[model samples]
Target: MVMEFPLLEGLSPVERREFIAACTPRRFRRRDIVCHEGDPGDCVHLITGGRLVVRVTTPLGHTATLTILGPGDMFGEQALLSPDARRTATIVAVTDATTLTLNRSQLERLRLQHPQVERFLTTSLAAQVRRLSASVLEALYLPVETRVLRRLAHLARVYADGAGTPALINLTQEDLASMAGTTRATANKVLRELEDQGVVRLSRGAVTVLDPAWLATRAR
Candidate 1:
C-alpha cells in the first residue's frame, strides 16, 4: 500500500519528525473527497499512505485531472504562504489510506520554526512550477492521445521503483480521458492502440506498461 511513495529525501530526520508531530493523522476510504474546489484553503495534507487525484471542473461541466499524488507528497502548502488563497482543485483519495493534516496556521508556524521545512516547501514548489508549466503547454499544444500517453508515462515513472520495475497505474478509462481532456471512448481507443502495439497491457482499471520506451516515445 505504500508503493510509489514520493521521497522527501532532502529533509533531515529531525525536521521530518517535527513536521509529522505538528500534523494530525487521519484515514480516508477509497474515493473520499479530501478537499473541494473553491473551498477555503485550511489544511495542508501530507500523504503518508495513499494516492490522491487532483481535478478541476470547467464551466461546461467537463472535468480535467491536473495530477495524481502519492505518499510522501504534500499539497495545499501554497495556502500557508498566501493569506487569501482558496483551493484551486478538488482532491479525492484514490485508495483507502492515511494522511497527516496540518491547518494553515500550524503549517505557517512550522515554516517559521523550521528552516528545513521551508527548504522542503521551496523544493516542492519548484517542482510544481515546472509541472504546471508543462501542463499548460500540453493542454495548449499536444494532441489528446499524446497528452494521455504523457500522463501514462508519468504514472509509470512515478509508480516504478528507482530500479525501473514497472507497476500498474490503477485508473479507469474515464479517469484517463478526464486527465487528457478527451472523451472516454477516445481514451479507450488510444489505450487499445497502445496495447495492440505491445506498449501497454490493460486490465480493468489497471494499465501496465509493457514497453516503456514505446510509451515514452508517444508521450513526446
Candidate 2:
C-alpha cells in the first residue's frame, strides 16, 4: 500500500520532498517486530499510519514499553548518527502499520546533501535528552499515581480529540504502567479510581479524559 510520508512539521518544502524521496516504504502487521535491542542499527522508521510500541528489555528479560508512537513520530534515529551503533530498544507494531524507512547509508548521504536534515536531527536528539531527563526525575521524585497522571496528560495533549471524550488513540494499561514506571496493577487501580470519580472514561484499551484541567492537577 502506498501512504504519504508525513513531513516533519517545520521543515522547508524542498527538504521535505528530498526526505520523502529517500525513504523506502514498508508495511507491518500487528505485533510485528520492527527491530530488536542490541542489533546493529539499519534504519529509522517514520510511521505513516497505525502505531508502534517502543520497549526496552531489562537485564532480567522483562520488556516494558516506553511509548506508543503513531504518525509524525520517528524512531531508530540514534543508530543513524552513531557508527555501527546497536539499538537500545525494540520497536514492535502495536497495530497494523505502514512506515517510511531510511537506511543508514541513505541517511548519511542525506546529511551531506541536505545540511538542513542534520540540523533537524540534532534538534530531535536534544529533545530526546530532555525527555529522558524528565523521566529519570519522575522516577526519583514522583509517586506512582502522579507519574501515571502525567503520562496521561501527555497523551491527552498530543492525541486526545476533545474535552469529555476518550483519546482517539488506544493504549493498554500494560503500556501505561511501563511508561509510568509502575506495576500494571497499580496503573489499573489508579485508572479505576479516576473513572469512579468521573475524571476520565475507560473502556477496553481506550482512555478518555473528562476533565483535562483536573487531570493536570492530579499529575502534579
Candidate 3:
C-alpha cells in the first residue's frame, strides 16, 4: 500500500509513486538518535510509522524539545533547499520507527520531473513556520500549567494508537518539561494534579491520557 505523507499532499498519484520509488526505507529503535544537530544535511525523511522528537541544544548545554512527530510527518527537508545546509536540530525516535528517505540527488531529479515537488517543499516549510510561531506565542503568554496541558493534548493526538485504545505518551517528565518550556518539577506537579483529577495516569516513563477531550478543552 502507498503510504500517504502530509508533505506530499500536493503531488499527483503518479508523482507520489515515483517519489516513493526513489526513497530508501530506514528504521530506528526507540530512543535511538535518528540525526544529530550540526550533522551534514543529506536527505529528507518522511515518517512511515511510530513517533520521533525534534530537539535542539544551546551553547550552554541546555536542550529543548521542539516537537513530536508521528506517521505522515516529514523532517530534514532543508537539505533539499541548500547543499551547504546542516541539520538544525537532533531527531530521536520516541518509538521503533520507519521512514522513507529521499536524498538530495533524488529530490533534484524529482523537482525537474515533477513541478509539484517544489510546491510540496514550500508548503511543508510554511506549515512548520506557523507551528513554531504558535509555540513561541504560547511560551510568551500562556501560563506554565496551560502550556503543559497543551503539550499533553498534542501528545495525545499524535500518539493515539487507535479507536478504543489508550492514548499513551511515551516520554519522561524531563522530556515533557522541555517540550512545555518548564522545569521537570513543575511538569511533575502538574501531571500529578491531573492524575488526581482522573485526567491522566502517570507511570514510569509514560503517561496514559484518560480524558483527552478534557485536556484539549482546557488547553485552549
Candidate 4:
C-alpha cells in the first residue's frame, strides 16, 4: 500500500510513487530505542503509526525530552545532508510504532532525480532548528509552570485526533516532567492545578486535555 507523507506534498504522482517504493517499513515495540545520540546516522524515518520521543543526554548524565512526535512527523534528516552526520538526539518509541525509512543513498539518488525532495528535507531541517531554538529560549526565560503548560499544549496539538474528540496525551507524569525540564513533583503539582481549573483531566499514565485553547492561552 502506498503511504502519503506531508513532506512529499509537492511531489508529482510518479515522484511520490518512486519515493514510496524506495522506502523500507520498520516497526518498533513500546520503549524501543530507534536510534541513540552520537550514533552514525544512516536513515531518515517518517512515522507511519504511534508516537515517539526525541531526547538528549548531557555530558553530566542528565537526560531531557526535547519533544514528542507522532504520525506524519519525520526524524533523522540530518544524515541526508552530510555523510558524516551523527544522531543529535535519541529517539525512542512511546508506543508500538511503525515508520517508513529512506536510507542516505536512496535519498541522495532521489534528490538528484527530484529537486523538490531536497527542498522538502531542507524545510524539515529548518523547522527542527527553529523548534530547538524556541525550546532553548523557553528554558532560559519561562518559569517552570509556564514551561510545563507549553509542553503539554504542544503534545495536545500534535496528538489530537480529529473528529472533535479531546486530545489525550498517553504519558506518565515522569515523562511530562522530563519534557518540561522539571521534577516529577513539580509537574504533578502543575497538573493538579490544571485539573482544578478544568483545563485537563489526569488519570494514571495519561492526561486528557479538556480545554486546549484555555491551556494554550495560559502557556502564553
Q: After superposition, which runs of candidate 3 have C-alpha atoms over 4 Å from their true positions?
A: 1-3
Per-residue C-alpha lDDT of model 2 across residues 66-134, encoded as one tens digit per residue: 877777777877777777878888889878888888887887788788877876576667877987898
C-alpha lDDT (0 to 100) for residue 2 of candidate 3: 54
After superposing candidate 1, which stretches have Cα over 4 Å from the reference?
1-11, 158-166, 217-220
Off by over 4 Å in 4: 1-6, 10-14
Name the runs in model 2 displaced over 4 angstroms: 1-10, 157-165, 168-170, 204-220
Can you write out model 1's per-residue Cα lDDT over 1-220, one digit (the tens) per residue?
Answer: 2232243556677767777788898899999999899998877787877678899988898777867877767788777667777998999988786898877677678778786777766776887798789878988988887988987887776566457666678888888887787788999999999889888889988888877877777677
Poorest lDDT segment (10 consecutive residues) of candidate 4: 1-10
TM-score order, best first, reads 3, 4, 2, 1
- Candidate 3 residue 47 Cα shift, in angstroms, is 0.4
lDDT of each: 0.78, 0.80, 0.89, 0.87
What lDDT, from 0 to 1, does candidate 4 have?
A: 0.87
lDDT ranking, high to low: 3, 4, 2, 1
Report the poorest 10 consecutive residues by lDDT, candidate 1.
1-10
After superposing all C-alphas onto the true structure, candidate 2 shows an RMSD in angstroms of: 3.5
What does the lDDT read for residue 2 in candidate 4? 44
Q: Clash pairs of candidate 2?
A: 166-208
Q: Highest lDDT: which candidate?
A: 3
lDDT by residue (1-220, candidate 3, tens digit) is 2545766767788988998998999999999999999999999998999899999997789888877998888898889888998999999998899999998899889888887778878887998899889988998999999999998999998988768577988889998998899999999999999999999999999999999889999999
